[model samples]
Target: MSTAAVPDLAVVASPWTLGPLTLPNRVVMGSMHTGLEVHDDGGAGLAAFYRERAAGGAACIITGGIAVSDEARGGPDFAVFGVDGADERFRVAVQAVHDEGGTILAQLFHAGRYALVGGMVDRHGDPQRAVAPSALPWAAARGVVPEELTASEVERTIEDFAAAARSARDIGFDGVEIMASEGYLVNQFCSPLTNLREDAWGGTPEKRRRFAVSVVRAVRAAVPDLAVTIRLSGADLMPGSTTDDEVDALVHDLLPLGLDGISVGIGWHESRTPTVQAAVPHGAWLAYASRIARVVRGSDHPGVRVIASNRMTDLRDGEAVLADGLLDAVALARPFLADPAIVSRSVDGRFDLVNTCIGCNQACLDRSIIGAPVSCLVNPRAGREVAFPVRPTTQPRRVDVVGGGPAGLAAAVDAARRGHRVTLWEAADELGGQFGLAALVPGKEDYAATVRAARAELDQRGATVHLGRPATAADLVGSDAVVLAPGVVPRSVDIPGVELPHVQTYEQALRDGVPAGTVAVIGGGGIGVDTAAFLTESPDESLRARAFAERWDVTVADDVLGPLPQRQPVAQRTTRPGEQVTVLRRSGKFGQGVGLTSRWVALGRLRDAGVRMVGGVQEYLRIEPGALWIRDEDGVERAVPADHVVVCAGQERLEHSLESALASAGVPFALVGGARDARSVDAVRATSEALEAVRSLAP
Candidate 1:
């Protein structure tokens, strides 16, 4: 092992040999469903999608697992490999990637019990029925019980795996990968909870290993010249499922079966584990990949590469993981979805220009999980890259933006990049509007990075920025076009005693400090839950210091105090464990509007804080000096004692005085972001509006 002071990160950008082929770089695009298939053209849209990522500098692209058989298939959105004319379209995709100096691999998979029952047609064009080793329902997809695969059926399934690999190699794929992770078919057979079969495929660890090993052996025999890889879950993160030690043994057993590489995965969709969400700390699962790598390195064919994945958002961290000597390469799914040029930007030392993935799985995974076309919230051109290529405007105009928030910043940067004269104004002294406040919430600091990237782009494009000045009609006199993106204003509930001085809005509470003592947060939306998290945060600086120390293996004193002892009492004092906070909402569910994946982690944090939660508020009677009166869900009235009351019900659009003024002057104005729609204020809506407004203004 090289113990050099600084491990060369250029190695990540260097060529590496995998079996008979040498890849251009160490970076591999992780396989994921893009929902960009063309039913009429046999997945031509999907071809263009992978073409964009390959052009952006991915060394190799692994297509989303292509269904081997009709019975073990993903939904209609997933690309089918062996269907009529589908192989021809896949050949086009493979040529597209190869033309761009990249290799494309086909991930052949069988969904097994996890297959969407009745949602897809079989390989022979019949209604698809899911089959598994045992007749059990997949926990992730409720109400879908799979039929048990008969002994003869299991033999055919193994043959199907070999046929898929042969089909991939014949269609000009650079390699093949078996999907054995994420609670899919291979994973189901490996887990005792899902596979209760008393046959040869189950009842023991070695027997369970038989199915996966047999598939690999069959694929290798079918395609002797092409490379073969397997993606395996290092830990299922669920009860009665495979653990790290078991995965270690399993990989060691399969290495001698002509496998070229292994990628370690963490968690399953049905498992009650937080894996890839933004709330999961960055590089949290690298340790799992290290464990698997150790087992493979000790084996006979130790040269086989190991890839690490889950929540690796940037190249610097990827470089660090590679430097640790645990894994050979790091794979990114959402980061590439967020910015396909992540590798090229990093290679050019343009880290500031790279648009980082914030891991807000809103558009990418969450939308795809519900059958929507996959996209990026920040980039806005993910799946539609072929449709919306960024080009220089034919005719540009002088544009003035009225806010320095996400919408205004995005518009200014994009318009300026298109050779337009753009200027952005902010009433506040800073750039990020609500995004800055969002960063203050625990476990959400990554949002601020997006703001920073926007700022960098604005600087690079030379867009004029005016801070501490609100754009008005006078300032827009000479502008050919004006954009109204003043964002939104907090709305307080209408009730008696609502105007009390103690009643604070969510924004005010975050900008200012939470009042000392008990606090009651009203509303259970994303804003409310986050505010509750902020209020209930540990007050001990030492505790936070200790946490950081333990996580990074640094040393911290237990009672360490900072300079200015009197002013920073909390820095030296112990935690205030008795400090209480209550969250109330009119709706039954909490954390609405929070991204589906991150909501789990957010709620878990609030639970750990011991926050008192009450929903279905019958009424907000009034507010007094020491308490607020409200009715509970059971039709009972009560006085909730609190030193401070926070209202996070929602926000109202700011008054449109600027719009009316621009209209009177005929300034050819537009409204973007919360100024136009305050229903769901998120990066997706804000960035989408900005991209559309900028593109439409072009002649």
Candidate 2:
């Protein structure tokens, strides 16, 4: 098999000037909170993490948002630039990026109303309250209305920003970025929905913009030598929030404040809009940045560059956006999390080997929200880059990895990379077991790239991949060691009438089209919800044609016989009026195995599609001709009518017999993935476990 050639990224790989510094390339590592500073070492873990991206060819590495004041502090674990000994603590971090010829920026932030009272106590050893421009809280911050900031407090906060900027410059940072986006302190003052006070800093657009402008001007004056940049929200995506028209005026007012550049961040944390998810189109927010850049171009400070960010992962798209003069630099966050060396690999003409960001948000944002150190589902060594360095093994041996899902593929690649000969066998015709099915789900197609990246790595490392080949005990005889990742077997619930007509498994319903009229899925987990979504939301051709006409801004002619085929709403693609899907689970809440970042979207899609959801079924009585009887949570018996029943109860690990066979064959073996634990659903668990297993093996 021949590998495809890599794309030419000479223009994308070229240098560009930002203020007084000449960046090595156009790619910028956008600031992202990793939650790795939970330790008492004062950001050693955080610094090392940033160093990895700098070494990987990032031209500018922006540190995660660090607090600037005791009242504005988010948590004890967060990096603080306004506190004592801050300069000494960040010295090593600044030197690391400089040593790699990469410019580093300190993202000075203040949580504002988003700051929790408990977090304040943890950070300052004294309880403090949150203060906003007005008494408003984010949608997620319900029941925690903040006390409005007094005029005096606001002035002090501005001074805090200046002090933080001065501290960053003193610590050897090349620049300081005021985080004014993402519904934080400055954004709260900028947005109409959050800022309502009739003071000098609120009420009117110009007044609301006063707070952010003051911070920028103060920071510029405090640190004359360091570059001053501001992160602005391109779109707040909230009702009554700052609109694009308002942003136009806001940018016009801020450009002359002695600012060096602007980074356009999109959406707020409380936004109902899809911002960074895989569902959002790549470079969808470029227009927001382009509009801001145009505003700057018309100003006296046209040299102040606009860095386009949010959902920008593709190199080709970045180059095109930059070529069109839409943005001076492209910022990527999760893509760097997936592949720290993405820019280096692209420059080396090995783009095919680059691990692309799937934008699942499973391990990154979701974990950080729950107070866990952020990691990546595709890349295990994201935050632990310094801890998990791949080195050559002491001795080489033959290894067999059976199964080609995430675990099997990961193990095979690890073994081969460690100077061992590896053979990976899969019973299916293609790789990616459940992960493949997940990618096929609507709005989740980005997951397919994960499998492609793993396959490319396996091939590049000289691992033999055998599809449609089931490995037997006899095949493991010549192997020094065998790693069995045989995947999972769907476990069908034993309902009395489950063997009746129109009854099938979730896989069967998906592979073979479900019967028309009505469908019922048994289980409310990610798999079950996805199956229901697949059944209810499959696109129709007539609907697609109408949508196409509307998207192209074309006026379609009415049909000669009557009106043209009517378009169905994207959220309500139920095929026909009578056709519906009912999803049932043993528990009350749905999306059992879904990640925190994607759960709301998944459930929202189901709700918008009008899928009937029922939970807390005490028992499954039986299946009848047109109805299935079950005991409700309250011990009341009920029957749900359906045209077809799809079972997505769970999976059973079937590695016992294989284990016995390998033992009888005198082969030492280890179990991985679903073969070891069928309960493990997320790819993070499976791949991490597999890598640990391979890392411990004696050659």
Candidate 3:
């Protein structure tokens, strides 16, 4: 497949027609916490980050969570849009976006009870009280005690919104979005759980809606010409919280104030539904937006547009929602991170070539929480556009890529895009290596999307993909350079009874789709743990305890056990009554590489499903009558019955063969992915190394 003739992305001719000014496009780059703006020079890096997105194709890019005042700053690194006389820095940022033919919006926010006052003071040079509707802090860990804003302070806050809007207009911004969602100051006041005030600002649904309406009215009055959008939570998702009816009433009341659009998301931070928030399918929150759109469109505010965002990554789904008239525009977060040219691809019908976001949340939101620069898990050049622009090399070179996994596919796509003729060879017919298994896990369908996108990109970039062709020294003989991305092979750990008829590797099990009656998994690494979780039935505490006692010489005093040391938190425990399975970890630690949020959920599920976890398995030997004997790490030998065993000891580097072949053929080469190293840490490190290697060879 050749994609050399692909044209540049199309530009939006008219974004909006607001009385006099004609905006560029309906697509809005919603504000997210980029964390880059915490640095001095008023977040110049952050300014450039937004500018690049605008340059790439966003009609309007909203700056990160910008505080309306010092006390309202949520995080240590939140950008301050309310700094007195800081209009010059914002002007520079707006000019950068304008120079790139894109409009910019300032997102005005107040953290309310969500403010990390101590951290804010440490970073921004001052600490102030966080004003909320009622005197209740949002999170206990942040140490923020919310103070009720007095009548005078409430009036001042209304003025603050107006002032912020006016400042955005003065600094050359085309619009400002009032953030009343995700449990920010306005959202906190809107929720019944947080807002208990009596003086016309809390209690009833109408009262709780007062603060947001006042803010919106004030902002609209301050900047009548600016395109003002209000971001609101369509559903609070908390128990005893604001219902959908209340949200509809709130939007209905605010519609008369001349608001331009509404952006809806789910939950406050504390009440966030992980299934809806992170793990569920794409466009999971579309129903919430659909409900809001139905209400807004049904009301007297017929001209007002609706922007639907929240896991709306699939172009087809987004287009369907648009065609259905459920939304005027779809705001994407991770998809834009994966490929800023996503809209362009969708418009051009090259949707398959669009690199999709896998919703891992590791590099994006998780990293932000940990105080690191934002980036994409798959696409390395996210948020670093200034430093790592995609430009063609002055001179063309021939490159050979061994293996057809994520890393190899990435290198091939990037190299071909950089004006290189590339040939990618895979020993197997399939491209994705371990990712093929990763896709099988529940709530991981997006991994398949990432794989398909990479393949499409290689095809579109004019790179030759040779399937089922293992490259040798002869194959690399004439290549100018080679990239050794041949991934690892499963390691064989010698243990007695391991040669039993049913023992097999994870790859073999996946490939063959074997079914076993009773199974035991050996090893405690990420792959091992995942394999154990996959093979074992659901969690059941009583049944699991009975099985453990019967099969292995172990006794469980408690029905529910906490996560092992160095493991992810376990949320709940139950048992799968009839399922027969036991997981024996050679290492003392369990759930080692799981993410904090996922670990809790997965562990809870496993415990509830009756999977027996036996830690500290030492020596293994075959016993009489087809049984397996094990010596505990405590030096006590015991026998455990197992009908089948699965080895999940994990993979090791298989690059020596490819490296030797390349060397023997005198081919200049780079190494990438797990082929570069055996450990999981090699994934990112190898990608970075491969990029550097290509840059060094570029002419």
Candidate 4:
């Protein structure tokens, strides 16, 4: 295969000036809530996390939001400023990054009404209440209303921002980025929906934006040498919020405040528009950044660059976006988590070897939302660099990786990289097993890229791959150890009419498209929902993009984004024209196994496509040539019009009978992925276990 990059990525590799700072490239490792902010190891683990990405060639890395006050925390684990023992933590991380010739920034943040974690503890170990512009109760906060910030409190908050910036500079941070976007405290103060005050900080749009301007003015005065930037919302994506002109006007308000850059963010936490989910097309939000850049360039402060973030993960897409000459830089968060060396690989023109973020959010966003430590599904060693170093093993051994699915692929690559001689055996002709099928689904093309990356890595590490070869006891005779991961098969349900010609397994439906007619899918797990999404998606790329826009109401235009961008109401989107798909589950939500952050997006996609989701299906009455009958929750029998019934009730382990046979042959082996457990198809767990299995085999 050719190693040459198709697109000329010279533009992404080029440098651009942001005020006083000259970045090495246009790729910025955007800030993410790592949940390591509250790690038990003080700052050692957090230092490792940022230093690894810095070592991987990130021109500049922005740390996750650091709360200026306890009342401003987005969650409990959020990093809080002015707290005890914070300076040492900041110094440790700063030293680690500086040692690698990298610049790190502290992101000053406040949550306002969005602080739902019962508020972070104060510097004196006393609890504080969530504070906001108004005494509004957030829906997720369960009736806990934020205490309306008094005028005095608001003034103190601004001072806190300045103090935090000064403290960050004192701790050796290169700069500080204000977290004023994505419906955070500053953004909430700028929106009418959240800010219901009439004091100097409220009243009109100007007053609503005064809070942000004041923050910038104070921070600039406190630390004039700090490379200061702000993350402002190009579009809040919230209904009845800041207008497009208001957002544009606010950009002009901050241009003269000694700002260096503006990183454009989109969508609020409660917004209906899905911004960063996999369902969203790559670079869907770039136009918003371009809009902001136009405002900056048209003004006197054109030197202050604009950054495009959210869904702009791929380096190729980043190159294209930058080549079009709209924005100055592309900020990627999860992509860095997936592959820390993403920028380096692109710089070396080794794009094929980069581990692509599939945008599943299984580990990163999902865990962050629930206040759990964040990691990557594709790369399990993301934040655990200190625990799982990539140093070559002193003793090399012959390792046979049985099964070339995701688990086998990850294990083979890791083992080979650790100085083990590996041979991969697959029952199928191709490598990816379940993941390849998942890639067929709409908006999931990146899933296949993961398999491709692993394959290339295995080859680069000198691992032998045997396609269309199934391992047996004889094949494992000379192997010092084995990593068994034969993967799974479609689970069989003994329901009536399964033997009919109309019935097919998920594997069959994914490989061969179903006949044109209403389709009925059994089960409502992640795989089931994926199968349903695949059946209903348009085959043409243009048509698919169009449908996605219609369903989510994406604005790819250069016009300023405002409130209520969704063309169709939530209720009306359910009635949109599409192929009829019925997803039946015995109980629970439609996307049961999916992560909380993405589960709603997947279900919403199905709902928008006119998919009939029938939960609490008491009984599967029967199936005929053209339809299926089922007992509803109310014990009412109904006929679902369907030409074909696809079974996606999950999977059972494929019994290759190799595990026992290999053990009897006196071969030491470890079971991973489906070979070890078949309760459900969890790619996150499977991949992590595979990496751990390799570590266990090390001498």
Which numbered prediction scores highest in TM-score against the true structure?
A: 4
lDDT of 4 by residue, 1-699 (tens): 122333557788887776667777888889998877777676887889888888877878899999887777877788776565666777888898889888889999898888875644666678767888988876887678888889999999999999999989898888899999988889989999999999999999999999999999999998899899999988988878998899999999999999988999997888978888888766777778888999998999878878988876667677777776768888999999998888888778777788888898988988888788789988998878777888788889999999988888888888888889999999799989988887777778778778988998889888899998888889899998799999999999988889999999999988777877788899999988988888876544345556666666666632212221221121111112345789999988789898888889899888877888889999999988888899999999989887889999889988878877877888888899987889876888898998888788654
Q: Model 2: runs farther than 4 Å from truth?
A: 1-11, 41-44, 82-89, 119-124, 138-145, 477-481, 538-579, 624-641, 660-669
Error of 4 at 624 (Å): 1.8
lDDT of 4: 0.83
| Candidate 4 worst ten-residue window by lDDT | 567-576
Segments of candidate 3 deviating more than 4 angstroms: 1-27, 39-48, 55-57, 82-93, 117-119, 122-124, 128-131, 138-148, 275-278, 473-481, 523-525, 528-590, 604-643, 658-668, 681-686
Please report how far candidate 4 places residue 119 from its true position, in Å.
7.8
Q: After superposition, how far is residue 415 of candidate 1 from its true place, in Å?
A: 2.8
Query: How large is the C-alpha RMSD of every model relative to the true structure?
Result: 5.0, 5.5, 8.6, 4.5
Per residue, candidate 3 scores C-alpha lDDT tens digits across 108-138 of 9898887766644633455666778888876
lDDT of 2 by residue, 1-699 (tens): 011223555556777888777887888899988876445466576667777788888888887888887767655556676454555557777887787778999899998888765544634466767778988765555467788989999999999999888888878899988999988999999888889899899889899999988999899999888878899998787777887888888888888888888999877787776677764545556667877898898888788989988866666656666765646888999999998878887677766677778888988988877668888888877887556665688788888988888888778777887788889999999998877776655555556667887888888888889999898877888887788888887787889989997898877765566767777789899888888767865443234334323443222222201222212223333343323788888975698787888878778767766788889889888887778788988999998877788899978786546688878888777887788888856678887777777666534
Name the regions of candidate 1 deviating beyond 4 angstroms: 1-8, 38-44, 123-125, 477-480, 495-501, 537-579
TM-score of 1: 0.91
**What TM value does model 2 have?**
0.88
Worst 10 residues of 2 by lDDT: 559-568
